[model samples]
Target: MTVPAYLHIVQYCAFGIAIIANSLLLHLIRMRAGLSFGRYRVLMISFSIYAIVYANIEIFTLPVMYMQGAGMIFYVDSVLKNHQDIGLLIAVSYCGCLAFCISMLATHFIFRYIAVCRQHHIHIFNGYKVYLLLIPPFFLFLIWAGAMFVCYRPNEVKRDFYRKVIADLYEEDIDQVAFIAPLYYTHQTDGSVLYRISDLLGCLLSCGILGACFTTCSICAYKTYNKLHDSAIQMSKRTRTLSKQLFWTLGLQTLLPFITQYIPVGLVFLLPLFEIQVGKTMAVPVYLHIVQYCAFVIAIISNCLLLHLIRMRAGASFGRYRILMISFSIYAIVYANIEIFTLPVMYIQGSGMIFYVDSFLKYHQDAGLLIAIVYCGCLALCISMLSTHFIFRYIAVCRLAWKMEVYSTEFLT
Candidate 1:
């Protein structure tokens, strides 16, 4: 299957997981009601809202991905090419979703930090305060999303993107490509002489909001951690454990959006602002490298979290599963590290860094050769380890499933 197809399947799986997990969480929260921490319930509600928004965003994005992969660019391009207002609405909503995600994560961090650090001040976040906190991001995004419309005419920027895609496909000079069709659609010009000012505005808006939220959360987390370490502090053992869980969960939540979305979008904006000439071919590898790097880090974080959860729930007597899990974790880490490390290095080397090879390689020929050989060895080891790990895992899981199936069949008979 194609990469986009694989990604599409993964997205659907994620959506399924989100639906089930979030539904269970919400149901449990309702069942427990006053039993658990009030802040947790509120956070879960926020998470649910964010998940719905994210799913919607994915719904819009999947079609574009499918269209691209299916060689139906003309289908999307025609609408984007012909209808200025439709393109503007789509662009604005997409940007809004991106900002909304960050905003929600920021709120998650803030809520968790406040709940742990400032118990006395927790009442401030209750009742109407939650609504007060959550609603502003919607309005803020609406304003920020409108910048595209204000900064440029509807369909103008989108037309540029479509034209760029067509030019690359036709092997035409992308630099000289312009909209040659007659002025059939109405165009609203913002008349801003600033170069790609909409992007700068977007960067400032997204970064400003997220930065503020991050800073606030950091301060709260520090104070809370310090309090936890203090013997004088009167927090219950359960509270402390819950606090740690909250922090870990928030950390994962924060990292996913920041790594996957925030940084990539920031780069997208900055590249135009800085005039980084990334050609069509070069862009894919760079984009994939960024994605893989983020996934690598996230996988490590998740493995650690999973280990912690296992220890917490299963104690030290997990038996064979402990060894199995540990081996899987180790292999995953090794493979991800190798993949992430090699991809960018390979990209750099393959891209033909003449200056580096000429100047540095000339002076350090022996060292460079040694480094390359060591890297090759490590890459080979990673491949071998991953192959073994996958084979063992598949056999173990399949055997377990077979046993379960046999037992079920016997019971039915």
Candidate 2:
């Protein structure tokens, strides 16, 4: 099967898991959920509904993501490939779905706080008021989706920036591709890259949304955790056990995202602002070295080919790009060699992890520091080269000459 077809299988499997897993959860909630869980049970079901909807969108859109600096480009490779407008909407809506998940989880935390700590205010979640609480998540979903739709709209400039990379990577014509990117900077008519205020603001808005929801969830989670253990609550053994179970359940849900979504996304967005790039790693246990090594081999071989091609075929047609590509290919090969030779090892102790790669050189380990520096230097070069190449494409296509004055006021602001 084709790559996307395989991805579709994964999406379909997730859909099945969503349905079955959520079905089981709902069944448990229906049968065993106590009076204290009445408000939470309803919200939990809605959460499952959101999950199913998210999976459904993935099945339809099947987006492939590529991150560049503080920006991300999404290429939709599903049935909607020909329908760029619809595909764009579907792709942007993925953000909404994730935001919905965040908001719903936050709502649950808010409700849990009410149920556990402030029973007198529990009436706020009863009757019609309960459904009213859905407004925040719904609003957040709209805000997230709306911001992306407005900021990341497809344009010649975007296609110009990513055209060759997309064409080279996906082997598809940029004209026919349906892609969206909320770029932090766009190459201006002149040669310099300018900060895309809208896109940056959109990203900041997303962070704000995330922060608000997380803060709400954290405060509520903390309060609920405390109240569940409080001695003055005067609860029966059964009631206390059920309340504790619910509190723990909600806490686990909150933590899963902090690991999966919040922290990683924060880093992904942050690293770009400072122009740092760490090519790729399993970031898991040592057993995953097989995957890392396989990637290293692939990187080495592909970069060798890329370097050779640039040398042989990157004539006048490649122009200035010829130089950048050659540098990148060399950097990739060196990076792979560094990984392979060092065979870096990492271990976890308590709550922290440390990783160090000793150079294969004998006795004199002074070279290890140089190896580490080279690795970081390669990443920085890779990131900057990518940005330069994209701007080159933009300037070449747009043919806009940037005056030196443009640099002082608006470039990379």
Q: Residue-wise lDDT of candidate 1 within 331-408, one digit each (tens)?
A: 667666655444433323464743222213335768555545554676677677678656655655677775355434
Q: Which candidate is the best by TM-score?
A: 1
List where candidate 2 sits over 4 angstroms from the true fold.
Answer: 1-9, 34-36, 187-193, 277-413
Error of 1 at 372 (Å): 15
Badly placed stretches (over 4 Å) of model 1 are 1-34, 62-84, 152-165, 170-199, 282-284, 304-314, 341-413
Clashing pairs in 1: none
- Alpha-carbon lDDT of model 2: 0.72
Candidate 1: what lDDT?
A: 0.56
Ten residues in sequence with the least summed lDDT for candidate 1:
65-74
Q: Estimate each model's TM-score.
A: 0.66, 0.65
What are the per-residue Cα lDDT tens digits for candidate 2 across 1-413? 12334446766787788778877887887788767567667788788777767878877787765555556667788899768888888888876877888888988888878887888898877777888879989999999999989988888877777676666556766678677777787555777878889888877888898899899998888888888788888878877888776776777676656665566566555656665543222342322344356667667756776686578767876555566677778878877887776666556779998656643542446677667666667778778888987886777667546523332235525
